[model samples]
Target: MEHPLSQFKYCPKCGSKHFNINNEKSKQCADCGFVYYFNPSSATVALILNDKKELLVCRRAKDPAKGTLDLPGGFIDMNETGEEGVAREVLEETGLKVKEAIYQFTLPNIYVYSGFPVHTLDMFFLCQVEETSHISAMDDAADAFFIPLTEIRPEDFGLGSIRQGLVKFLSALK
Candidate 1:
């Protein structure tokens, strides 16, 4: 896979072709003394467990791995914390208001969008719904359902980072 910032040929600030990679995570503009850092974007996912201990999962409705299983989450928007992002994504995708969310863990992921490798930091949260009986799939989720944690196969997740996170989540259960 190519670097996330490999598509950037010219400097955005100075509009010069002299922009060059200063290192793996940054670029420098020779003409205007401008430096750009390619930091990983932050994303959030919710691990909502019901009373039965079944975990909520969603099916993607769009590509970059559409039709694959995923946790209810999305990229964290500017000005929002990871916890807030998880709550918002959960409501948008599952239509369930988050009562509370606790920080679980974070994993680095490479999210390919439109064939561009955008790196991300996926922060997972353990949460519960205010109303479990009323869940309707919305937004980019084609469907959302709960499944036993033991039955979840990491390979079923199309996103490599998600699969890795699931494996860690399962291992922590022991």
Candidate 2:
């Protein structure tokens, strides 16, 4: 609801409001002459389904997607392979240890930092959680649970990422 950097009156380095909003996050500084573009990182996610055919979902607490439903995921850290990132993200966000990975697709997504070139690649997979018996919500999730596939709708999805993944996944099932 609020901009992450809305409180700054000046740049931390130069102390000037010479930077104007390119949309919500980006700025072109007329005074300090700096290119402070916030580029996005690659993110990976897994769509988990239990024996009951319910789909696992998480409520996001951080931005780029706060207060939305999402498959467990986050930034892909440096030196981490795409599979490694997906594995780590699932454990960090859902406390579920995933041992198997099936690369589904890689999507190039563009979103306005508020409305400006914040582009990121979102990688998705369908994973089988190894430790379902010990599953719990971890870092970024306010809550986590399994919802029946019929219950998943556009609003239940955090963004186009999960929705797109789910559509393909369900279609394949048919």
Candidate 3:
């Protein structure tokens, strides 16, 4: 795996070429004495189940995993809590207003964006929606729908963290 800061050739603080690896997770600028840390971005994943125990799923609309199965969630925006981020993401991607978002487990992920790996800590949540009948694929989701839990294959999920998280979730239900 490439270091998260491997692509950076100059110090962001000083724009100097003297930037060098300070440690496993940071870099230091020899010229300006500036230290930059690469921390995992906070992300969210929603686990929405309908009355029939069917899980809500979406299809990726863009690259990185275009057309592959995904959950409805995304990176937490500035100043947003995990719960708020999950609810907002669900609404944006599936048009479903989250009534509740219960905290669950978390998984570390490496999301490749713009040809660079973005390390992320994905916070999973069990979400309840106000309405399920009006779901429409929106935002980054190309398509969205509910699928029977028994019929879901974790391998079909495009993201590694999602696949791992799904396996853990299913195992917990057993």
In model 1, which residue pairs have backbone atoms overlapping below 3 Å? none
Model 3 C-alpha lDDT per residue in residues 10-97, reported as the tens digit of each score: 9999899999999988999999999999999999999999999999999999978999999999999999999999999999999999
**Candidate 2 or 1, higher lDDT:** 1
lDDT of every model, 2 decimals: 0.90, 0.76, 0.96
Q: Candidate 2 lDDT, tens digit per residue, 1-174?
A: 445445445665676777666555566566876546555668887888899888888887766567888888767899998889888999988888888878988777654455443467888888888756666777988878888888877556667767777777778777
| Rank list by TM-score | 3, 1, 2
Question: Local error of candidate 1 at 43, Å?
Answer: 0.4
Give the per-residue lDDT of model 1 (tens digit) for 27-68.
Answer: 999999899999889999899999988889999998879999
Taking all chains together, each candidate's TM-score versus the true structure is 0.96, 0.70, 0.97
Better model by TM-score: candidate 1 vs candidate 3 = 3
Q: Pick the candidate with the highest lDDT.
A: 3
Best by TM-score: 3
